[model samples]
Target: MLAVTILGNNSAVPAFDRHPTSQVVTHDGVNYLVDCGEGTQIQMINYKIRRGKISHIFISHLHGDHYFGLVGLLNSFGLLGHQQELHVYAPSPLQEIIEMQLRVADTRLCYQLHFHTISGEALLVDNEKIEIRCFPTQHRIECYGFTFREKRKPRKLILDSVKQNNVPLHFYDNLKDGEDFITSAGEVIRNEWVTTAAPKGKSYAFCADTRYFEPIIDHIRDTDMIYHETTYLDNLRERAFERFHSTSKQAALIAKKANVKRLLIGHFSSKYDTLEEFEKEARDVFPNTDLALEGVTYRI
Candidate 1:
């Protein structure tokens, strides 16, 4: 399963119980932390997320609101006696920042911390289970958006037909790989006759803080779902551009242009406590938009 759990949604400062920008993307039992904002670990604990399952983290930028909780979370991992290597993908300067804090306190982690600097559009992870890639976003400083794509799943077996035909259990793996099964009596059973095609792989895109930009459409086009920041209302479009932030309508336009299956909008400015208007403004343009509520899990 490919899903994203929102931990914090508010931008800059915490308000209305919203902390900062943090999310957990889970696929096939592995969790990827997208942005480590302040109080991230606490949010994860409150949400019943297994911190031990997180082996990779992707920070969109070095802004404090975006990544202030990273060092604390890493330290907590060490305290928890987690021995697996931790991989963090972010800007190159983040390595120095993390190292300085570790140095000052004379801290030593039980596991290795590998920092992979994202430069422009780069593929971060590619394995049998999942694929992750990053693309540059139009923020004030260098920032990036990440896309997670699940690998194709195995073909499903026809239980009744397989049982009736006496197909051996050991051949199940072969059948899932689309190989024809041969019975002991020399009768060949076609793979499709007893197995269904694999399910379509799901994909999710996380677009971090950015101004109204068009190039982003290419990076997140046609995704199963996308999380885009809508930091302000349409009336403040001028202010949003000055601050390198996006308005609700602007984010919706991107979702509409990209033809995504669904859109999630969050990162609200602390100026407004009530988020009903944000949803109304986005849905007006893109009907499939949803508010990114804290602690909610959005399945990709």
Candidate 2:
């Protein structure tokens, strides 16, 4: 159930029916929002994203395109009577910015709102079901990328083996935890003999606005999938580098170098009227690349 729904994928400006940078990473019914660009609320409504399920929001940078819709969304949450405690993680100065906006409007939220200032690479959230961490990205301003990893599942029990071994019901839990079982007579049964290892947890990384930075490969290596910004086509490599952005080929190169299972490229520049060439160019280098189309849900 680990997936990300793209709300707005365009970069800087919204054009050609595309919005700004925003998305929702959904895992096991809980939603973690990443970036709140302009028109984020409208895009969420268009995509049918359950705003109530979002308990945490991660803003990558201070750029207007990345956070212009944040205060509005927060205000809407109050108006909508959202009851869950809300947590926001971002770099410095965002708390000050949000407070000023809230103060000017004199809007009092009904629910508890928490803001966490991200300092360098650190673990943001680690609960029973998921672990989320942030790493720095090479953006024009201070920016960060986020990694969402599902917690490793418990080992599955072999019903026949447990029944044949006469293992007590109370010992089942221990077996699932990969613990060896001992009988009253001091007979030891290996955990592997009664249970199979659970599947490895799925993982996804949101590589917020960045250039062709190789250091990023270290943090995103071997992820199930990653959404990297391809702000320009291959021919505009120079322009992308100058703008602190990445081209389609560059994004694909990152995915290939990181050994990710799949790559989702978005954050397209407004100059491009069509995206077919972007996908084709990226796929040339990384066959598993796909366009991060708005309103599309990509399962990791």
Candidate 3:
């Protein structure tokens, strides 16, 4: 099962009811923390998220609202006696900042910490079941978004077809790979007679913090679920543009254009006390849009 849990949803500052940006994506048995804002560890605890299960942490940009909790989370991981290897993916200067923090504290982590800086347009991380690709997003500073796609297995060979046709067991592998089998008598066994294509897997996209840019539609096209930042309402459109952020209506447009199944919008500006307006604005444009409430879990 693939799911995303919202740890914090507020944009810049933590309010009494809302928090800064942070989320945890759970795919298979692995967990990935995206955009560790301030008080994220406490947020994780409040949400009952298993911090030790997170193997990777992804930072969208250097904005404090998006990454201020990183150092604290890392330090807490060490303090918790976490021994598994941890990987961090972020922009260039993040490594320097983390290293500086470690240096000042004179602390060494218990696990192997790996840092990979994203410089180019796309960075791919392939595993046995899931593949993640990071793409550039238009923001004030160098920023990026991530696409997580689950890979499908090869098609299954039809056992009844093989038995009825007297095909040998050794040729099953070829049939599963969509290849025709050749017999000793030079008979060609059609792939359609023995195999069927695998079912298409699902994908999730996180379009962190960015302005309304049409180019991103291609990268997030037809995603099963997309989490985009809606930091302002339609009335604040000018302010959103001035701050290099997106309004709820603009984010809904991207989700609508990309044809995503569901749009989860968060990173709301702290100025708004009630999020009902944001939800109404987005749902007006895209009916499937929903507010990304803190502590809520969304299944993809």
lDDT, residue 63, model 3: 92
lDDT of 2 at 17: 96
Show where candidate 3 strays beyond 4 Å. 166-174
lDDT of 2 by residue, 203-286 (tens): 999999999999999999999999999999989899999989999999999999999999999999999899999999999999
lDDT for 2 in candidate 1 is 95
Candidate 1, 1-300: lDDT as tens digits: 999999999999998899899999999899999999999999999999999999999999988999999999999999999888899999999999999999999999999999999989999999988899999899999999999988888999999888888889999999998999898889999999899999889999999999989998998989999999999999999999999999999999999999999999999999988999999999999999999999999987
Question: How should the candidates be ordered by TM-score, best one leading?
Answer: 2, 3, 1
Quantify all predictions' global Cα lDDT against the true fold: 0.94, 0.94, 0.90
TM-score of each: 0.91, 0.98, 0.94
In model 1, pairs of residues that clash are none
Model with the higher lDDT, candidate 1 or 3: 1
Q: What's the CA RMSD for each of the models?
A: 2.3, 0.8, 1.7
